[model samples]
Target chain A: MNIVENFDLFAPRLINKKELLSGGHRACSGCGEVLAVRLMCKALGENTVIASATGCMEIVTSMYPTTAWEVPWIHVAFENAAAVASGVEAGLKALRRKGKIADCDIKVVGMAGDGGTMDIGMQALSGAMERGHDMLFVCFDNEAYMNTGIQRSSGTPMGASTTTAPAGKVSMGQKTWKKNMAEIMVAHNVPYVATACPSYPLDFIRKVEKAKKVKGPSYIHCFSVCPTGWRCPSDQTISLGRLAVETGIFPLYEVENGKYKLSAEMPKKLRPIKEYYKSQGRYRHLGEDEIKMIQDRVNKEYKKLLNKVQCLEAWS
Target chain B: MAKRVGMEVALAVAEAVGQCNIDMAAVYPITPQSHIGEHLSDLVADGKIDAEFVTVESEHSAISAIIGASGTGARVYTATSSQGLMLMHEILPIASAMRLPLVMGIANRAVSGPLNILNDHSDIMPQRDSGWISIFVENGQEAIDVSIQAFKIAEHKDVNLPVCVNIDGFQLTHMVEPVEFPDQELVDKFLPPRVPFASLHPSNPVTMGAFAMSDYFTEILKAKDEALKNSKKTILAVWDEWAKMFGRTYKPVETYKADGAEILLLTMGSMGETAEIAIDELRAKGMAVGLVKLRLWRPFPFAEIKEVLKKAKKVLVTDRAVSFGGPGGPVCGEIKAALYNEAERPAIYSYIIGLGGRDVTVGDFTSMIDKVNREEVNTDTYEFLGVRE
Candidate 1:
């Protein structure tokens, strides 16, 4: 297997020393969030600064004198990463104007987990996007509060089991569908909004690059498979991310200026959602009826997205 | 050559910040503190000041955004009061611990319950251990002076901690007074552009606010504590320099007619002015009473407070905020602790007064002094002065 032989013509040019996110950190084995972050940094290159929310990524990468981040990074608080990113962008602009910093090409990236983006940090994230600052906010969506022992988050899909929303005899796991954060960001009328997966590295890298190019606030909701919380085989992290997109559970798409386009549209017959569910213990309690309920929800949402893409294409 | 004009205190503070040529400002609308953000926004809009004025959604983001902006090496400013301060309480320590040289103007107001938006120290009192250097002003001129000095002190090489300049809400923020705005050249010479100790630049690539475990957490906290405690010298040095350049002097604990007084009164913020008037009237009655106003609260100004109170036979401390079931008012409690180890300290008396925007007039001050002189109150605990029976 020649490393350079398989490079796709359309894929981002991968650089050597691509470990902006180095190894020897505390992330669980086969952590898909770290992989997504690495691909993002590869796309953004060395001239990027990150304001990370307090989560698995932050706690794992930055532990005192030891750090995995080769690029500049700051973690202020859990719910204010977006706000802090706003400040970083404004500060860089101010510093550039003052001639304090010569290079003005530095990009500010706001990184947060699903909990940080969908619930506690929603206000700050919305404010940052609405303010139209030049930055990218990436939500590594692992579904539940993986860093805090699998408590349920708004991003947790229905029928998925979590500590807070367990599948008891009388109740389902999560009562509601996963929050449509990418759509919520699109509602802010931002310049760019996209959803990507770590299993599809090229697509994830491409979306991050596109987000970087957009002038104002851009957002990318990346699907990160948490093996620890999901109780799946550690080696199955990347496979689960792939299965999520293929099963129409987590669609890979982008909204550019209200124009929707699916980055990886599924085949004529999408893979059964049960395949994705059965791979993780979070959904082990779901019976046939529960699986059908999730499949119905997934199908309805996927059709809605497809209709949006078709409508946009017709207008164009 | 300096420009002196009568302006509203909040606007004056905005103007002084403008004069410092800050790179960005994050504003949130909170009463008494709103006008400062409004005026700063107008300044940014009118191009009177070249800065980025971000109108944030809430006080939490306001501090959070400034933390980010300051992280990138931009000189930034923000303002809030009362509940807004409470909202910002969580992030205040982050700014100090990260050692961001940001400046904030707190229009001092009472924190709500009965929900009052009036003058008091309750807003800043609860934030005592947030690791930011706290200063208070007595008038509009001092408000402008201290607000300007705050940037310098915060950005000082040795003291790269955040600073808060507390101007009494409504009493100073809403009132118009003659404030001497320093010349741009003077300010330029005085405050060189902020030089951040560790900025978030892609070229340098350093991590800030990293997670520290038990092995290093205490030492990191100790370092931050030392920086705050050592900031007193830089604060004094900055004030001394400002006096030489602007002809206005400030001290941590400034006195009023305290020379050879048998009794002394302690106060913070604008209440010092009313206390002074009371001192004059009492001195005419040959009571030999004086006033000692606390200009700087944090680092507690322990040495100066002890030195000033050591001479008086009896000292009365006024606090606008309560410790609720504690021995005394918040300010008075600190005073007691500071003087606890002193070989010779004053017979201290604590009074809780002027709360929830209640007026404390010269008459009230005199009455309190009379009560103390007559030994009518218990020395062990604090009394809520001017309370209805």
Candidate 2:
């Protein structure tokens, strides 16, 4: 039982938390998306329900008569995940008012892919946030519409290759810049909006824990690398994620009320963006000029985010 | 015993919703369907009905609000038509999938393109696969009667699905007819309270909606499909109980003098009355003609339609909507598919008629019948009746 000693540290300290996500899922081998979800479930523990949209996660989890979700789960349409979660939260509250349910700390969490969070499901998300439902919305950003054959979505990074935004004779790759979903969530005036990457498991886990305690709507945007869609090595998923944060391409930050704070502060001397870009095949076709363009965009956005955080800190 | 009085179909539906003692109603005013919401709202505001009248911003919000309220184990109702129904296209499936027992009145109307607000099936036809049990009422009396029965069918634990009662806009909606208002005590006894499986309460915190990963997506969908399909028996049982209590009988497919008929005219909503008159005129002329009224559209009475149309040699299915490049109108195409494999099925001639509030008379129906008899029956086609060429 040498494995017991290895498990003792993370497992014993970990309260064999009721597993919400059962094993034996149908996700592809070494699927980082599901792995990120598994870790999220571990952090969320039991006593949680998730409202998911239609995507790779949904298709692979519940097949016919069997289910991989141990907890009570519901799969609505692609765009109404937020609305459905709101209904769940509202329904639970109503039952409590009627004195039907016991006083337990149960939470409702909404999970969806980038497309569902940033584009199609935006209205429902906005509505739920505006209504101030007590729930958590977690967006697993895998860049493109991985479930629907690598189509372009708002979360797809610029200069990345997708079926709809393929690198062509004239075009470099995805023409548009990645949508600022964290800022969008903050604009709704939700209680919390934070960005995390699976590469930083402790940080990602901490964000999920913080979101559960928030009174109103709390949003968590997790960067989940897609090996199949991003054309990267399966083993390089964590490294690529780490490179993203280190290169200042995807800065980790959180917005509490109106105050912005950088979760992981980076030094003024940052690594070259080329180190992150060249590691993935999706950006392999980029020449020096294209790489320079992408690096410039990333630097500008990061600087803007830093300025917002600094200004908010000074004012508060 | 209850006194019967003349009432518009929309008012009848409103009365039925009130009598059922629904807890919440989220509605938006739309043509033909406006009266249904207005009457219910008036009832709620005036203390005639103890319910929450949520005046939503749009039809989408109306349905969304109902889903939220219903998810909280409250009996909820709403009414909309044409573009209003189209606006609720996204939330419709969500309501059904969550297994909420929501009842809605759809004043059937032609969808806009040429900007028309007339009686047609174009509105409800697009929602055929939306997983709600769709019931069509021919007149004011049936609208009142069926609406009461709809709550029973929708809220039954075995049939936790949404129900849509469709009445032709400007036809049955505006037309006044004798409707028997059942006693409120009887309605309260017959329609039980809604028992939702999940709600948003702080005490017993059970989640109503949750994310299903690839590990469990198909099972949820299959369960939803089975629940909807299995609800047919409950729908029939509820209708039977309603008929027994109120002494008004209803069937999925109601046939009018179809026995031994050579030609059968099939229609839904108020147009069934027009077809009945056409049948009477043709029968006087020694023609073996009859009329079949479709009362239930979803959980589409396939077996009943086949049984009713078994004896007919020629079936004329007149639809008040067109399906563009599709197989004639939506209903006719569905009817065709239902009877496609039947060895003794009759010939179905689909005619798109009475669209955009065009007046549909007995004469117009007779002409369509004549075309069916002449073997000039247009199959997989559309013909707009009573229109200026």
- Residue B56's C-alpha lDDT in candidate 2? 56
> Which residue pairs show collisions in model 1?
A87-B69
Candidate 2 lDDT, B121-212, residue by residue in tens: 88988888899999998888888888888888898889899999998888889888888899988988898676766654433434444455
Off by over 4 Å in 1: A1-17
User: Model 2, range A122-205, lDDT digits (tens) per residue?
Assistant: 887887788787899999999999999999999998899899999988988898999999888999999999999888776777
The DockQ scores of all candidates, in the order shown, are: 0.84, 0.14
Q: Which ten residues in a row have the lowest lDDT in candidate 1 chain B?
A: B323-332
